[model samples]
Target: MHYSFSKDFFWGAATSATQSEGRVEGDRKGENIWDYASKEYNHRFFDGVTTEQTSRFYEDYQEDIQKMADLSFNSFRTSISWSRLIPDGVGEVNPEAVVFYNQMLDELNAKGIQPFINLYHFDMPMKLQEIGGFENREVIQAYKKYAETCFELFGDKVAYWFTFNEPMIPAEAGYLHDRHYPYVVDFKRAAQVLHHIVLCHCEAIKSFREGGYSGKIGIIMDVIPVYPRSQHPADLYAAEMADLFYTKSLNDVILKGFYPEEIGEILRKYDQLPVVTTADKELLSATKIDLLGINYYRPRRVKARESVPNPEGVFSPEWFYDNYEMPGRRMNTSRGIEIYPKGLYDIAKKIQNEYGNIDWFVSENGIGIQDEEQYLQDDMVQDDYRIEFLEEHLSWLHQAMEEGSNCLGYHMWTFVDCWSWINAFKNRYGFYRMNLETGEKTVKKSGLWFKDVIENQGFDKNN
Candidate 1:
C-alpha cells in the first residue's frame, strides 16, 4: 500500500439511529420529532417516504453488521435513539430497546469491530418538542438525565461516546432555514437553541465524568472551512465573519469551553444572545471533551455582500456575506455541493494550529449520489465516482497527518444506503445500496474496493 496508515487507525463508516434503524413506531418506541414531523408535514420528505421506511436496521442489524465485518471494517460509528432508549425521553427505559442495543454491541464486539456510539443525531422526542425542544432550559436538564441514563446503561460496553452529531444543524436548519422540523425562521430562537444544545453537551460530559466511565467522550461537528472568494479586504473580512458564525461558534465552545467574544458580540448586537448563567459557565469549563469528530463534506466559499442588507430585515448569517461559487470548482451535481477535497486538509491544519492539536477523527465524509441505480452493473453498482471521491479526500487527510495533525481515524458518512432527512432516499451515500422497495442490499463497487483498502491498511495512489 502506497498510503499506509497507522496499525490502529480506525477504518469504518457511520450511521445514525433516525436515518438507519427503521422500526419507528415498533418495540414500544415513542414518536420522535422526525416521526411526527414527517407524518404531519409529509411534503417535506421526498416521495412522502417517512422515517418508518428507513434501512430497517432494527430488524436486520445482525445481517448488516455481518456485512460490515465482511467488508473489513475495524470500527463503526452509530447513534443511539433517544426515544428508543427512553421512550418518553425522560421516564422509564424500554426493555426491548435495551435488548436490541445490547445485542448489537455484543455482535460488533464479537466481530472485533469497535463501536463508537453517539447519543443524539437530530432525533428529538416529540414529548420534548412539545416543551420547546432545546430552546428550553428544562429540556436541557431532561437531556442531562437522558445522558446519565445512557452512561449507566451502556458505558461499559461502549468506550467511545459522542454527545451529539452536528449540533449546529438543529439550530441552523430548524430555526433559521426552516428545513428541519418545528420549522421557524427566527434568529433569536436559533441562538437560544444553539446555546442550550452546548449546555446540554456540557451536562452530558459532566455526567460522564461523575459516573466514572472509563471511555472517551466528545461531540461531532460539521466543519466547513470558509474561504474568501478573493484576496480583497472586504472578501477576507466576510470569510472571517462567516467562519466565526458558521464553524467556530460550536467548535470553540466544545474544544475551548467558551464562546468566542466576537460571536457573543454579534449575538448581542442583534439582541439574540442566549440567556447564560454563571453555573452554565462553570459546567462548560469543567467538562471539556477528550476527543473531537469532524464531519467535512465541503468548504464554504464567501465573498463580500454585493448590496447592503435591509436594516429592517430579521438577523441571519447571510447579512454579512454572500455565498460565492468559484468558477471551475469541482461540483457534486447530484447534491449541489462543491467537491473540494483540500477542505479536509485545511480543517486539520486549523485544528492543529488553533485548537491545541486536540485528538480528533474524520467522523463523517462522503458523497451522496442521486439516481445511483443508473450506475448498476450486473449484481454490483459500479460507483467509481464515489471511490474517486474517497481516494482524493483520504489523500488530503494523509497529508494533514504527515504534518503532525492529531487526526486518529476516518469514517465515511454511512455503511449502507439509508434514508436522509427531507431528501429521504433521493440521494444514495452508502457502500451497500439498498433497494427501497424490497429492502435488499447489494455491495457497490466502492464497498468491494473499500474492503481491500481496509485490509491493506491503505490504498495505492498509483492505481
Candidate 2:
C-alpha cells in the first residue's frame, strides 16, 4: 500500500442498539420512546416498519461479531440500550439483559475486537419521557444512575465509553423540529433540554471517575463544518453564527467545560437561556473528557438572511442565517445529503487548532444507498459508489492526521443494513448487505474492498 495508517489506528464500523438489536420488547427490554412513537405514528415510518424489525443482533451477535472479524475490524462501536439494561429507566437491573450484554461483550473480546460502548443513542426510556425527559433535572439524576449502572456492569471489558451519540439531535429534532419522539416545538424547552443533557453527561463522567474505571469516556457529536456561501462579510458572519449555534454550543460545553459566550448571548437575547445552577457549572468545569468522537456526513453551507425574523416569533437558529444550496456541489441523491469529503478535513483542522488537539476519531461516516439491490452481482452487492465515498473521506482524514491532528480511528456508520428511525430500511448503509425478508447477510463489494484496506492498513488509489 502506498498510504498507511498508524499500527494502533482503529478500523471498524458502528451500530446502535435501537437500530440493530431486534428483540426490542423481549429479554425484559422495556419500551423506549422509539417503540412508543413508532406504534402511535406508524405512518411516519417507511413501509410502516417499526423498531422491532431490526437486524436481530440480540440473538445473532455471535454470527455478527464473526462477520465483523471477517471484515477485519479491530474495534467495534455500539450502544447499550438504557431501557433494556434498566427496565423503566431507573431502579432494577434486568437479569436477562445483563446476561445478553455480557455475552455480547465477551464474544467481541474473544474475537480480539475492542468494544466502544455508548450510553444513549436517541432511545430514551418511555418512563423517563413521561416526565419531560431531559427537560427536568430529576431525569438527569435518573440518567446518572443509569450511566453509573452501565459502568459498574461492563466497564471492565469496554475501554471506550460515550455518554451520548449525536447529543444535539434530541434537542433539535424532538424539541425544535418535532421530528422525533415527545415532539414539542418550543425553543425554551429545547435550550433547557440541551443544558440538562450536558449536565447529565458531566454527572456520568463524575460517576465513572468516582468508580475508578480506567477507560476513556467521551461524547459523540455530529460535527458539520459550516461554510460561507461566498466571500462576502455578511456570509462569513452568517457561517460563524451558524457554527456557534449548531456545532460549538455542545462541543464547547464538553471540551472547554463551559458554554460558548456567543451562544449564551444569543440565548439570553431570546430569553431562552437555560437554568444553569452554580453546582452544575462547577461539576462541568471539573469533568474533562479523554477522547472525542466526531460524526461527519456533510457540511452546512449558509448565507446571511435577507430579512430579520419577527420579534414576536419563537427563537430559532435559522434567524441569523439561511441554508444555501451551492450549485455544482456533489449530492448523494440516495440520502438527499450533499457529499462533501473536505468537510472532514476542515473539522479535523478546527479541532487541532481550537479544541486542544484532543485524541479523537471519526466515529461515524458512511453513504446510504436507497434500493441498493439493483447493484448486486454474483451474490455481492457491487457498491462501488460506497467504496469511492469511503476512499474520498479517508483520503481527507489521512491528510488531516498527517498535519498533526490527533485522530485515532475511523468507523463507518454501520456494520449491517439496519433500521433507521423514520427511514426504516429505506436507505441501506452497511458493509454487509442484509436480506430483511430472510434474515440473511452477504458481504458487499465495499466490504471486500474494506477488508483489503484493513489488511494493507490503507488503500492505493493508483492500484
Candidate 3:
C-alpha cells in the first residue's frame, strides 16, 4: 500500500512526567499521588516493587533526547511535573526544574525535535490532593495558575501545548473505579471530579490565552471508541452511553462549549449534577482549543449485561450504561479492550463531520507487550506484531487525512519502557528496552521500524 501521509507530518513518541521521572518522593519536589500510592501498593507493580528507577528519564533526559533523535523523530511530547515545577502547586517555581526542562527543550530542538509540552498528566501535587484533588473547585484555580506559570516560563521554546493528558481517566479511575490514588468509589464524587477536571482544562486554556501567549493550546484525551454488539438496540444505546461518558463528556465541554444532553440526563437521574457557578459556564464557553490531541488505544465492545442493582449500595452513572462484552470480538492482549483499527478512522470522521474542522494529532497510540526482551533475538526485539499494529492504525489515519481530517502527526504511547501504577513495570509499550537492574537501554526492532516510518513519512508495505 502506498500510504503517504503529509510531507510535514510529525512523528515522535510520548511519555509522562511521573511514570518515567523517578524522583517520586523527593521532599524538594513535593509529594505526588503516585509516590504515596506506589508505597501503599508496592506489591502490585509488575517489577514487584515501586520505589525504583524507571527509564531514568529524569536523570538522563539529555541522552534519551539523543536516542529519540537517533530514532528520526521530528517531534517529542513530554510533561512538566506540577510538583517538580512548583512544589506546593502554587508557590515559587523550582529553579532546578526550570533549568532541567529548559535544557531538555534546548537539546531536543538542537536535534531538530520539536517539543510538545503538556501541563498535567496524572501527577497532581500532594498538597492539592489533601484539599480534595480534582473534587474541589479551588484546584481548578490552582491549575490555571500552574498553566500560566508554564506559559510564562516555557512559552518561548515550545509552540505546541496541551492542557491535560487523559484527564477523564483520573476522574473515573481515581474517583469512580477504585484503581488509582484517592480511590473513592462513589459516583457523586466521580461526577464532581469530572466536572472539576473539565473546568480546570477550560481554565488552563483561558489562562494560556489571557497570559498573552499566542500559541497552539489544546487538551489531550485518551478516547476509546465504543462499538455495539450486533444490531441490538440496547447494545447500541449502551455503546452510545459509554461514548458519552468517556469521550463526549470532555469533547462537548472543549469543542461544543457545553455538556452533552445525555450527561445532564444521567446526572439528573442520579441527582449528582454538580453545582455549577456562573463563572464555570463563562470559563468553559470562553476557552476553545486550537487543536485536539487524541490518544486512541482500542475500542470498547458493549452488549448490555443484565441489570444488577447498584451492588455497592452506592449511586453510579453505570446504571445508565451497563457493561457488556460482545462475543467473538477482536480483543487486545490487555484483555480488557478490543483492537479495532477502524475506530481511528471513525474518530477522525467524527471529529471532522461533527466537531468542526480542527487540527488534531495522534498524541498516543501503541500496544502493550508482556515483555520487551521476550521478542528480542540478537540484540533486537523483532516486534513485527507492533509494526503491523502501527501500520494498520496509520492506514486508517491516512484514509482519514485523505478524506479531510486535519491530522498533523502520530506519536506513540511512549518512547521507552517506563513504570506504571499498580500494574507498574509490567507492560512494555516502548520503542526502546530499559533494564532496571542495570542502567542500560537498547533500541528494539520496533524502534528501528519506527525510525524508517518517521524518515519515510509513512509505511512502505511493499518494502
Candidate 4:
C-alpha cells in the first residue's frame, strides 16, 4: 500500500547548533554551557566525549545543506546557539554569529529548503548558568532580548521559529535527574526551572508578536504519551499522573495557555509548586503559540506507586507513579527507549481531541544505533533497522492524518549522526552517518530510501 501526503507537506530532519556547529572557541562565539561543562566536568560525558568536537557544520554547512537538497528535504530544523549569538548571554550580539547564521539561512533558502529555527536547544550560555540558568527569573528578560535579536536579524530568511526544543528535558535531565548539566537532583529546583522556561517562552512569543516578524513562533515539546500497564483504576490513575507531569505540564501552557488544575494540585500536595505570581499568570494567560513541534520517541508505562516515599527522601516525578516495565515490550536497547510506533498515533489523536486540533508536526522522531559501525556494508551503513523504524512510525502517522489529524509534516530526529550530550556518538540516528574519525559523512541506505519518499510524497509499505 502506498501512503500519501499533501503536495505541500514538509519533508526534512532536525538538528541543533551545539551538536553540529563544532566551533566553540573561535570568531568571538561565546562559550555555551556545554562548552564550559565539557571542559570543567569532562568526566560526566560518555568516554569523556566532550561537546567541543562533533559534526563541524560551522565549516561544512554549505556542502551539508547541498546534501540535504540532494536528499530531497524540502524543510529543515536547527537551532541558534544562545552563547554563540550573544557571547555573554545578556549583552553584545556576536558579529561573527550574525554572519554565520545569515549565510546559513540564505543557503538553506537558496536550496529550496525551508528553515525552522529554534532559539534554544539546551545550549545555555555559561554566563547564564553561572548566574542561575533558567531558575533565575531575570534570565527570562535576557532571553527575550536574545530572541528579538534573532528575529531582527534572520526573520527575512526564515518563516518558522521555535522558542525551545523539548523544554521538559532540561527540567528533568538537569534538575530532577543527572542526565545533563547542573546535575542537581532536586525536584523543587526542577519545578522552578520548568516554570521559568515557560515564562521565557511566553516572553519570546511576546517579543516575536510585538516585533511583527513575518513568521510563526512555537515551542518543540517532547510529548511522551503515558500508558497504563493494565486497565485497572490504579494503573489508569498512575498513567494520568505521569501524563500530567511529563506531557500536559508544558503542552497545556503552550497550547491551551494555562496549566492544568491537576498539575497544581499534585505540586501543591508535595510542596513542589513553583512560584506563579499574578504577573507570571497574566503572561502565561496572554501568550499563545501559532503552532507546535511534537518530538515523540517513546511512551511511558506506569503503575500505581508500589511503595511510600519517606518524608526525608527527595521528591521526584517517580514519587507519583512507579515506572512499569511492560511485559515483552519492544525495546531499542541502544538508546534504552521503547520502539513504540503507536505512541505517535496516540499523540496525534491527543492533539486532535484534547487541544482543539492545533497545527503541529513530528519535529523529531528516529532510532539510534550504538553499534552502527558494525552495520557498514560496501562502505555505507545498511541501516535497515532505521528504515523499518521510519516506515512503521510513518505508517501510523499517515493513519492519524487520514483520521483528521492536524499534523503538518514529519522531520527525523536529525539529518546526520550528530553529537548527543552525555551519550556523545554512542547512538547514531541519521540518514547520513558521520565518521567521527575523519569528519566525513557517508549516506546510509535509508537516505536513498528517504529521498525516494520525498520525491514520491509518501512511501510504499510493500516495497
Candidate 5:
C-alpha cells in the first residue's frame, strides 16, 4: 500500500465510556440500560456470562493513555456517561464523576492526545429509560440539560464535541428490532423515538451555542451505503429507500435541517410519521452543527421482493425494502457484513456534494472477528485481513480527498477490545487486545503497523 493523507490529518482511535469502562455500579453511578441489559441478556452473552472487568479503563487510564501515546495517535475519542455526570438525569453533578473525567481529559491532553468528547453513547439513565427513554419528548429536554452541563464543565479542555453517537441504532434496535433494552416491537414508538433523538441532538447543539462554548459540536451517525442488487428499477428504488431510512433520515435533518422527501413519504405511507410540533421544527431548523462524524461500517444490498402485508410484526425499515445478499460478495470475518471499502469514499462524496462543506472525520471504522487469536502467532496478531480492510478503505478515502472532501480525521471503532452489548466477547475489533481475565493489554502487529501509518501520514509501499 502507498498513500499520503494531508499533513494536518487527525489520526487516532475511539472507544466509548460504557463499552470500555466497567466500574458501572460504583461511586453512585446510576444504572444505565447497558448495565441492566447486560445482566438480563447474560445467558446470550459469550461463555454464558456478562462482562465484569470490561477493559478496566476506570482503574487503568494511565496505562491506556500510555499505550495510546505510544501508538503515535494524536486524538482519542470517548463518550461521557450522562447518568454518571447527573445521577438523576438532571441537576446535582457528582463530584467523583467530574474528578474522574477531568483527570482523564487532562491525562490525554498532557500526552498530546486531543480528546473528542461525545455527550451520549447509548447509555441512557435507568430513570430516563423508565420514562420511555428517547421515545418520550421530556427526555429531549433532559438531554439538552445534560449537554449544557458537559459544555459548561469540559468545554475548555474538550474542543471537539459530539451530541450523540449512532442515535439511530438505539431507536431501531431497542424499539423495532427488539434487540436492545426496553425491548419493544413497536414501529410507532420507533418513529417517535427517532424524532425525539433527532430533536435531542439539535437541542444539544443549540445548548452548546447558548452555553457560550466556542468549540466544534457535531453528531456521529452510522451510515452503511446501500447498493441495489441489480439495475432493475424496483431493486434500485428499494435500495434508495433503504439508504434514506437507514442512513439519511437523521443525517438529512442534521445536515439539511429537514427530513428527506422520500423518508417523509415512507413515514406517511405507514401512518407513523411523528407528530412534529411547531416548536420541534423551529428548534431543529435553527440548531445546526459545526461538524459531522461519519461512521461507515458496510454497505447494504437490496433487491425487490413481493410486498407482504404484516399487521403485527412491527413495521421495520426492511419492510419498506427487500434486503438481498449479493452473490459472492466479499464477507467480513463476522460473515454478516460485506467488505465494501468504496462505501467510505461514496460517503465522503455525498457529504461534499449534498451537505455543504463541513469539517468531518471517519469517527468509527473497523473489522470484527469471532476469534481474533486464531489469526495470531508469536506475540503478534498477524491480521493481514484486517490490514487489507483498512488499507482498502483508506485508498478510497484518499480518492475522496483528491476530489475535494474536507475530511479532517479517521478513527477506528475502538482502541482496545471491549464488551459489545449482546455480541459480548463474541467479536473482537481492537488493534490491541485486552485480557478480560486479568485486565492486561498487549499490542498486536496491526498496532505497530498503525503507528507507522500515523507517523508517516499513511502507508508506505516500500515497507
Candidate 6:
C-alpha cells in the first residue's frame, strides 16, 4: 500500500531554542528559569548536565540549516528564546540576539525550509519568575509587549508564528508535580498559572492581529488522548475528567474561546478556580488561534481513583483519576511510555469533528531511546525500530488525512538530539546522531529512509 501527501507538506522536525542553542549566558542573554535551575539545582539533571551544553545551533546554525535541507525538509519549527531576546523580561531588546535570530531565519529561508517560529517553550525568564511570572497579570502585558517587539524586528522574515508550545506544562510541572523549575506543590497555583498563560497567549494573538502582520499565528499543543481502563461508568467518567482537566482546560479557550462548563464546576467544587475578570472574558472570546500544532507521543490510560484522596489536601487533577499501566500493554521502554499509534488518528478526528476542522499539523512526534550509542554501526545508527515506529504512526495519520482531516504536515520532535532539559542527552531523539565530545554529526539509517519518503512524497509499505 502506498501513502502519499501533497508537495507542500512539511517534512521536517521541531526543536526549541533552549534545548538546541548553547551559550546560555553569553551575548547579554538574560537568565531563564532553566539557566537558574541548572546552576542552583544541578542535582536534578542527568549526569549533572546543564543547559550550557547543547547541539550548538547558536554557533552552527548555518551548517545545521544546510543539514536540514539535506534531509529534504520543506518546513522546520523552532522557538525564539524569550530571555535571550529580552534579557530583563521587558524593555531592552538584546541587539546581539536580534542579529543572530535574523541570520538564522534568513539562512533557513535560503535553504527553502519554511520556518515555523514559536515564542515560548517553557523557558520563562528568571526576572519574570522573581516578579511572580504568570501568576501576575502585569507579566501577561509584558509578554505581549515582548511579542510586539518580535513583530517589529523580524516580522517580515518569518511567516508562521506560534505564541506558546504546551503552555500547561509549566503550570502542571512547576506548581503541581514538582518536576520543572520553581517546583512547588500547590494545585491552586497551577490552575492560576495555567489560566494566566492562556491569557498571555490571547494577548499575543491580539498583538499579531493589531500589527497587521500577513503571517499566521497559533499554538503547539501537547494532546494526550486519554483512555479508560474499562467500560465501567466510573472509569469512563474518569477518562472524561482527565481529558477536560489535562487537555481541554487550556485547549478549549485557545481554540473555542471558552472553558467547558464542567471544568468550572470541577474546579469550583475544590476551590481551585483561577481569577477571571469580565474584561478577560472578552479578550478570550475574541482571540482564537489561526492554526494549531498537535504533539502526540502517547496516550494517558486513566482509571477511577481506587482510594479516596484526602479532602484536607489541596486539589489536583489526580484527585479525580489515577493513571494505571494496564497489564500486557505495549510499551516504548526506551522512553518508558506506551506506544499507541491509533491515538494520532483519534486526535485527528477530534480536530476535524470538534474544532471546526481548523488548520493543523503534527508539530512533534518521535521515539526517544536511552543510550542510543548501542545502535551505532559503521558510523551510523541502524535504527530499524525508529523506521517501524514512524511507519505505524504515519499509517494512521495518512488514514486520517484520507478521511478529510485538515492536517497540513508532519514534523518529528526534533532534528538533533538536543539538550532535553533535565533529561539532558540521556534520550536520543534525532535523525542525525551528534557526538557531544567532538561536535560531529552523522545521519542515521532512519534519516535515509525518511529522505526517500520525502523525495517520493509518499511511502510504500508493501515494498
Per-residue CA lDDT of model 5 for 1-463, tens digit only, reads 5789877798888889888877845667777888777787766556754535478787789899999999998999999988888987877888889988999999999999989999888889988998888888888889988988888788889989998899898889888887888888888888888899998888888877877877788889888888898899988988877888887887888888888888778779878888888988887788888878888888888888677757676677777688788788888858488889999999998899888867799999998888888877886778887777888888899889988999999998779988887787778888898776777789887788889899998885432
lDDT against the true structure, each candidate: 0.92, 0.92, 0.83, 0.91, 0.84, 0.91
lDDT of 3 by residue, 79-99 (tens): 999988998888888888888
- For residue 293, model 1's alpha carbon misses the true position, in angstroms, by 0.4
TM-score (C-alpha, index-matched) for candidate 4 = 0.98
Q: What would you estimate as the lDDT of candidate 6?
A: 0.91
Per-residue lDDT tens digits of candidate 2, residues 109-135? 999899999999999999989988998
How many residue pairs of model 1 clash at the backbone?
A: 0
Displacement of residue 62 (Cα, Å) in model 4 is: 0.6
Clash number for each model? 0, 0, 0, 0, 0, 0
Q: Write the per-residue lDDT of candidate 1 for residues 1-463, one digit (tens) a residue.
A: 3787998999999999999998844599888999998999998889999988999999999999999998999899999999988888899999989999999999998999999999999999999899899987899889999999888888889989999999999999999999999998989999889999999998898889888899899999999999999999999999999999988888888888888999899888778887888988887777788999999999999999999998898789899999999999999998999999999999999999999999999999999999999999897899999999999999999999999999999999889998999999999999999988788998999999999998888898764
Positional deviation of 270 in candidate 1, in angstroms?
A: 2.1
How many clashing residue pairs, candidate 2? 0
In model 1, which residue pairs have backbone atoms overlapping below 3 Å? none
Model 5 steric clash pairs: none
Q: In terms of TM-score, how similar is model 5 to the real structure?
A: 0.96
Residue 89 lDDT, candidate 1, scale 0-100: 89
TM-score of each: 0.98, 0.98, 0.96, 0.98, 0.96, 0.98
Estimate candidate 1's RMSD in Å: 1.1
